[model samples]
Target chain A: MTLQDYLPCLYALLACAGFAVMFEIKKPMFILLASATGMVSWLVFLLLHDIGSEVARYFLATMVAALFAETFARLMKAPATIFLVIGIVPLVPGGGLYYAMDALIGGNYALFAERGLDTAAFAAAIAAGVSVVTSIVRMAMTGRMNRRERETKKEE
Target chain B: MRAKQVERCLNFCCETGRQLIKNGAEIYRVEEAAKRMLSAFGYSDAEVFAIPSCIIINIHDGERNFTKNVRILRTGSNFDRLDSLNALSRKVAAKELSIEAAEAELHEIMGRKGYPAWISYLGYGFAAFFFTLFWGGHALDAAIAFFCGLLVKAAMGQMVRLKANVFFIHICASMLLVTVPVLLTALGVHIIHTDKIVIGAIMLLVPGIAITNVMRDVIIGDFITAVSKLAEVLIIALAIAIGIAIPFGILRALTGVM
Candidate 1:
């Protein structure tokens, strides 16, 4: 609702566009979609983190991001990984991993363990979210194909 | 007979798989593309097995069977190349492109250049700058992180040109990531938060591709690839941690500086 609330989304868009360049994404349209995907997913994560558990925040954010990527992939006729990689950039546990390593090097065992576990959990949650959605999408696609095939056979 | 024609087609198909895998395509997708191309060329009994580093393909034409193994020694992300290759495979599968034509197209795709080094450097700088802001850092920290990101990108480009090991490249990049921010702080630039800047700049080196691929490969039941990729992710993480830790430890031991 406020300007401050929109800052993170703007940052996500810029960061994702930067990532699209780093990945050498050639298509301008795909770059825009990827950045939009990143912004929407990061906004969702921000909103969820305010009201949900830490793990659910990452899980739901990734799932929604993958959903966007898959939809875009279908519409664009490109591989979903293209969108998924850049879209999920905002959710990667880069900071947590850094803090974990920093703590370990600083000889703070407790802080190291805490940050390490948190990073691992976030990583796992992201993986789970992506896997679940992708699998469901795959199943639905194949099921639709099979039904069409059966209908054509019956008509023949 | 038609054995020679089948041989050429199978060769083209396997090469396509190799290119896809080399460009960081998932194992399942590579296999699917290869198989689809083979079937389009009238070899429906083709089998393709693609791993992160290699692809093995077998094509059967009646009583004659041909098998080829391609080992991919290097892989990187170039989405442009990936998109073109994916399009090429789809065209081949749809019977729109003959084997020879597809081969030429593949060559063209492989030879296409990515964005120049300067553009990638700019990308790194912007990514760090925005990530700093996203992580709640002020304008000063974001500016410092942007410079650090440019430095890291340039250093990485130099390391790649020198044919340095990947782990060494990551270690060196991360070392620069930590050192630059701390050096700035030591120079009395009090507005920059060293922690936020380092975190932001380090995002440039994080293994986002590896982590995503690991999950995809595992879900698709390619455990070998998933486990290997997981190992790779951990190694890169370790290298980065070591890189960041050593400099901080040295700085602390010598001058009690953060």
Candidate 2:
């Protein structure tokens, strides 16, 4: 809704760019696309702030990132994992996991439980989201390939 | 097929699969690429199996069956290697390259060097800086995390070069990262958010993207690979948690404030 709210998206973009570099993404164009996927995923998470649940928000954000990755892979003729790896960095609950561990060590059982469960939920949601989209894409590609083979056989 | 031809085809397919897995490609992708390359070489009776750590290929050449396996000692995300390997496999599958030429290409891809160390260090620094800010840390905290990130990467690089196990490497890297923020906070830099800095730096060690890969493996019915990868993710998490707690305990005992 405001300029301030968009700051995290920029941070996500730059952070993903840094990771892309470390991961040896040689092409500048790919680095930009992968980093933009991160920004877009964060934006989606923010846009759906008032969603049904936090897990749902994470799931949808990861789905959008997965879609972006698949599209970019097809368009650029690269592996989708390259983009997917960098794209969802903003949504991974690395902070939550750290805080959960911190809480556990501090002997705060309640905070530890809360943060730990929340972090696992976020990870699972993102995992499910990416898997669902990738499975669909894989199946669709195979189906098309099969149809083409059948058509070629008929022509022969 | 001649014995020599079968051996060459087997070597090429196995090498392709091995490189793909090493560079963090999906199990299905590696298996499919190997099979495609085999079919292109007219080995329709080939059998290829790949897991996270090994690849086995069996080929029949009318008179004999040839089998070979490659053990993957290490695996990491190297997109450049994966991209080149993927392209190489596609070319092989398209029948665009001779066996000798494709082997040469594989050799070149395998021997290709990664980005220089300084670039990776800078990448880690900027990633930590921006991640700290993303998680609501102050500008000073981010600056502190940038250097901490560089330190973590340098330390981890040395430990890796020393042939430490992944678990030990993660433990030491997280402990190393936690020490910086904890030491800073103890030095009365009350402005630094110790947790944020530690989180930002430790992000370098966390297998966040690996979670998605594990899920993809499960979706594709690679239950064994998925379980092994999930175990890896859990092990790294436990190591990091232990790493962070060790620093906190020692520092708290010494300074009574961390």
Report, for all candidates in order, the number of backbone clashes. 0, 0
In model 1, which regions exceed 4 Å deviation? none
- Provide the lDDT at B45 for model 1: 81
Candidate 2: stretches off by over 4 Å:
none
State which candidate has the highest TM-score: 2
Q: Is the docking of candidate 1 incorrect, acceptable, medium or high quality?
A: high
TM-score of each: 0.96, 0.97
TM-score, chain A only, candidate 2, equals: 0.97
**Residue by residue across B36-96, what tens digits does model 2's lDDT show?**
8999999987999988999999998887899999999988889989988999999999999
lDDT of 1 by residue, B194-238 (tens): 888888888889888888888888877889999989998999998
Best by DockQ: 1
Candidate topping lDDT: 2
User: For residues A11-130, what per-residue lDDT tens digits would candidate 2 score against the true structure?
Assistant: 999999999988888989999999999999999999998887999999999999999999999999998989998998888888888889888777899999999999999988999899
- In candidate 1, list every pair of residues with a backbone clash: none
Which 10-residue span in candidate 2 chain B carries the lowest summed lDDT?
B203-212
The weakest ten consecutive residues by lDDT in model 2 chain A span A98-107
